[model samples]
Target chain A: MKIHGSISKTASFRTTNAVFIGRSIRLSLRNAEALIMAIMLPVMLMLLFTYVFGGSIDPSGNYVNYVVPGIILLCAGFGSSSTGVDVAHDMTNGIIDRFRTMPIQSLSVVTGHVVASLARNLLATAVVIGVALLVGFRPSANALEWLAAIGVISLFILTITWLFAAIGLVAGSPSAASGYGFILLFLPYLSSAFVPTSSMPSWLQGVAEHQPITPVIETIRGLLTGTPIHDSAWWAVGWCALILLLAILWSIVSFNRKAGRR
Target chain B: MRGNVIEVKGLRKKFGHQIVLDGIDLAVPTGTVYALLGPNGAGKTTLINIMSTLVAPDEGSVKIAGYDIVTDKNMVKRSISLTGQFAAVDEMLTGEENLRMICRLSGLTVAESNVRTVELLQHFDLTAAARKSVKTYSGGMRRRLDIAISLVISRPVLFLDEPTTGLDTISRRALWKIIDQLKERGITVFLTTQYLEEADQLADIITVIDEGRVVATGTAKELKSRVGGEVIELFNDKDDLIRTVSTTGSIHDIRQKLNELASIVSPELRVNIRKPSMDDVFLALTAKEMERSLS
Candidate 1:
C-alpha cells in the first residue's frame, strides 16, 4: 500500500486520544472480574445498610434517603480503584512500552484511563441509585439540584480516579494496585457515609468530619434533600480540585520516570 | 554512512554497576536487512532500544533516517517502528481491533484505517483469526500481529527485537518470508537475534556482539573466513575420514596433499570441501573472546 499523506498534528492527537479512550472502555467492560468488583460491593452494602441497620441508625425512619448519597459516593470511590488495577496491568504487560514508542500524544494514555474510570464510576453510581429507588428511597430534588449533584459527583469521580491511576502506575503489579484500593474503600467507612460524624468518639469524629469524602457525601445529601449546600459544597469542590491537580502532576512524573527506564 | 538509514557512533549504556553496551557503533545502509547477533545478556535488546529511542543512551548519538535520535525524536519516531521481544499486542482486543487501533493511532483516516487494517490482516495471514481476541491467539499469531501493527505506519526503518525467539519452525519461516517481502518493498529492517541461522539467512550484514562488545562484523562468508579457510569433509565408514588441512599455498600443493591422502586412505572415501557455516564462525569468535577474557 502507498504511504498516505501524514495527518496534521492536531488531528492526529485528537484521533489517538479517541482511540485510546474507546479501547480502554471496551477492555474495561469486557473484564468480568473487575466489573464484578466494581458493582458487587456497592449493591451489597446498599442492601445491608438499608435493610439490616436502617431502624436503629435512622430512628426518624428514612434511612434509605440518608444512605443513598453515602453509598453513591462510596461506589464512586471503589469504582475508581479499578482504574489503578487496569493501569498496573498495562504497565507490566508491555503495552505501555508500545504506546511510548508510538508517535501519539503521551498523556493520552493516562487520560484514556481517567475518562474510562469516570464512565465506570458513573455507571456504578447509577446502579446504586436504581437499587436505592427500588428500596423506597426518595429525594425531593429539583432538576437544577439534581444537575448540581451530578456535577459534584462527577468532579469527585474525576479526582479519585486520577489519584488511583497514579497509584496504579507506582504499584508494581495488579494485585499490589488492588492492595492500594483497600485504603480508598475503607475511607468511606470512617467518613460520614455510613453514620453521622458526631456519633463517633471525639478524635474519630474530627477525621470523619474533615476528610474529603465526608464533605462530598454531605454536599450530595444536602443537594438531594433541598438543604442549603453552605460551605460544605465549596469545601468538597476545593478538595476535588486540589486532589485532582496533585494526582495528575504525580501521574505524569511517575509515568515519565517509569517509561524512561528499559 | 552517507547512504545509511541508521547510523550510530560510540553508543554506550549501563544498568547501575553493570555495563550493558560498551561503546558500540553501527551503520546500516538503506533497504538492507541488518542483523545484530548476540547471546543472552550481550545487550542486543539494549542496542535496539537505544536506536528505537525507547531508552536513551548513556553516551553517543544515533541518527535514524537522517534525524538525530535526541534532538529530532519525533522525526526518528516517524521513520521507525519497533516490534519488541514480547509481542506487545493488546491481549484484550481482537486481532482486527488491534490493527485498527494502531492504524488510527498512526494517523490514518477512518476509511484508510479500515482498508489498511484488512490489508495487513490478510498479508500476515491473520484474516481467519481477525475477529478473535489476542488472548486466545498462539505465540506465532501474536508475533505476526505485533509486526503487522508496527508496519501500520509504513516507516522506512523497522526494528524487530528477537521477533522469532519463541516461535515454532513453521512460524519462524512464515515471519522470515514476510520480512523478505518487506525488503522487496525497500523497507530497511534492523533485527536482533540469538539464532545464528536467522542472521545468516536474513542479514546482508551481520554484527556479532558478546559480553557488551561487538566481537565481529561482516557477511556470513567473510566471518567464516576470519575463523579459518575452507573445511574438507570426508565421508567413510572408517574413523579416519575427518581432517583439518591448511590452504595457505598454491592449488598445486593442495592437489598434491589431496592425492597423498587418497593414496594413504581407502580410495572409496568421499571427500568434499565447503565453507564453514555461521554456527562455526560464531562459536570460534565467541570461544576466542572467552579465552581472552579468562586470561
Candidate 2:
C-alpha cells in the first residue's frame, strides 16, 4: 500500500472533539442513575436547609431565596465531581491505548469529560433553580443581573470541573479520584452557602470568609439579591482564573506522565 | 531489511530499573506476516508499544511505512492499526456505534461512517448483535470486533498482540482464518504469540525473543532444522513416553536402532518416529540460551 507522508490532516480538531464529546454525553445519558443522583442530592440538601433548618438559622422565612444560589453552586459541585470518576475510568481502561495510537489528539478524551460535566451541571443547576422557585424563592434581579449570576455560576462550574478532571487523570482509579474530589466538595458547605459567615466561630470564620468558594457564592448572591458585591467579584474571577489555569496545567502534566509510563 | 514496512535499529527501553527491551533490532517486510514468538515477560508488548509510538524508546530509531515513529508519529499512526492483547473495545457502546465512532474519528463523513459501520458489522458477522452493548459480547466476538474496528480506515500495517490468547480452539482457528484473509489482501501483519503452532501456521517469518533479547529469527522450516534431525521415541503398553533417542533420521540408522531396541528391550513396546516440531525447536533454542547464561 502507498503510505502518504502527511496523514494527520485527516482528523480536524473540531471533528475529533465532537466525536469524543458525543461519546461522553452518550455514556452519561446511558447512566441515568448517576445524573439523577447528582441533581437529587443538591435538591434534597436545598429542601432540608430551607424547611428544616431555616427557622433556627434565620427568623424570617426568606431562607429559600437565601439558599438558592448556594444550592445552584452545590448542584454544580455535585455534577462536576463525576468528571473525576469518568476520566479515571477511561484512563484505567484499555480504550485509552487505542486512542493513543490513533491519528487524533489523545487528550480530546479529557476535553470530552470536561465539556460533558459542564453541560450536566448546567442542567442540574436549572433543575435546582426550578425546584427553589416551586418552593418559595423570589430573586429581585432583572435580566442583566440574572445573566451575570449565570456567568459566575458557569465560570465556577467550569473551574471545578477542570480541577476534577485533573484529579481524575492523577488518580490511580475511579474510586481514588472520587475520594479526592469528595474532600474538595466540602468547600461549598464551609462557605457562606447555608449561613452568614459572621455567625461562624472566629477561627472558623477566617476560613469561611477567605476560601475560594465563599467569594464565588458571595458574588452570585450579590448579583441575584442586590447584596453589595464589594471586591468579591474581582476576587471570585481571579481565584477561578488561577485555579483553572493550574488545573489545566496539572491535567497536561499528569496526562503526559501517565501516557508515557503506561 | 530492504523495502520493510517496519524497521527498528538498536531499540532499547526500560521501566524503572527493569530492562524490558535490550538493544533489539527488527525488520518486517511489506505484505508479509511476521510473528514475534516468546513466552510471557519476553517484552513483546513493549516492542509493539514503542513501534506504535505509545512509549518512547531510550536508544533506537523506528521507521514505519517510511515515516519516523518518533518524529512523524501521526503519519506512522495513519499507516498502522493495533489490536492489543486485551480487546480494546468500549463496553458501554453498541457494536455498531463503536464501529461508527472509529470511522468518524478517522475522518469519515456521517453518511460514510454509517455505511462503513453497517458493512463492517455484516462482514465480521456481528450484524445480529449490532445494537447490543459490547459488554455482553463473548470473548471471540469482542476480539473480532476489536480487529474489525482496526480495519475501518484501511491502513497498510496491522499489529495483533497475542490475538488468539485466551481464546478457545474454535475461536483461535477462526482468527487464523481471518489472518489468512488479511494476508490475501496484502496487509503486513505483525503478531506476537507464545503459541508455536500459531506461529507455524500463520507467519511467513518468526522471531523468537526470550528475556528481552532476540534469540532467533528465521522461517519455520529454518527453525525446525536448527533443532537437528528427527527424533526416535519408545513407549510402553500404557502409551507413556519411556525414553527418546536422537537420530540422523537415515534409513540404516533407524533400522539398526529399532533392531537393537527390539532385541535388548521388549517387543511389546511401541516405537514411533517423530519429526522435529516447532515445540522441539523452541525448547532447544530456549534451553541453549539458559545454558549460555548459566555458564
TM-score of every model?
Answer: 0.91, 0.95
lDDT of 2 by residue, A153-183 (tens): 9899999999999999999999999999998
Best by DockQ: 2
Candidate 1 lDDT, B1-295, residue by residue in tens? 2399988999899889999988888889999999999889999988988887778888989999889988988778778888988888899999999989888887778898899999889888899999999999999999999998988877888899999998999999999998898898888999999999999999999999998888999888788788566655677766564655544345775687788888887777777776677877888789888999899
Sliding window of 10 residues with minimal summed lDDT for model 2 chain B: B242-251
Give the Cα-based TM-score of candidate 1 against the true structure: 0.91
lDDT of 2 by residue, B61-151 (tens): 9999899999999899998888987788998999999999988888888997888888888888899999999999999999989999988
- CAPRI-style docking class of model 1 based on DockQ: acceptable
- Top candidate when judged by lDDT against the true structure: 2
- Which residue pairs show backbone clashes in model 2? none
Model 1, residue B186: C-alpha shift (Å): 1.0
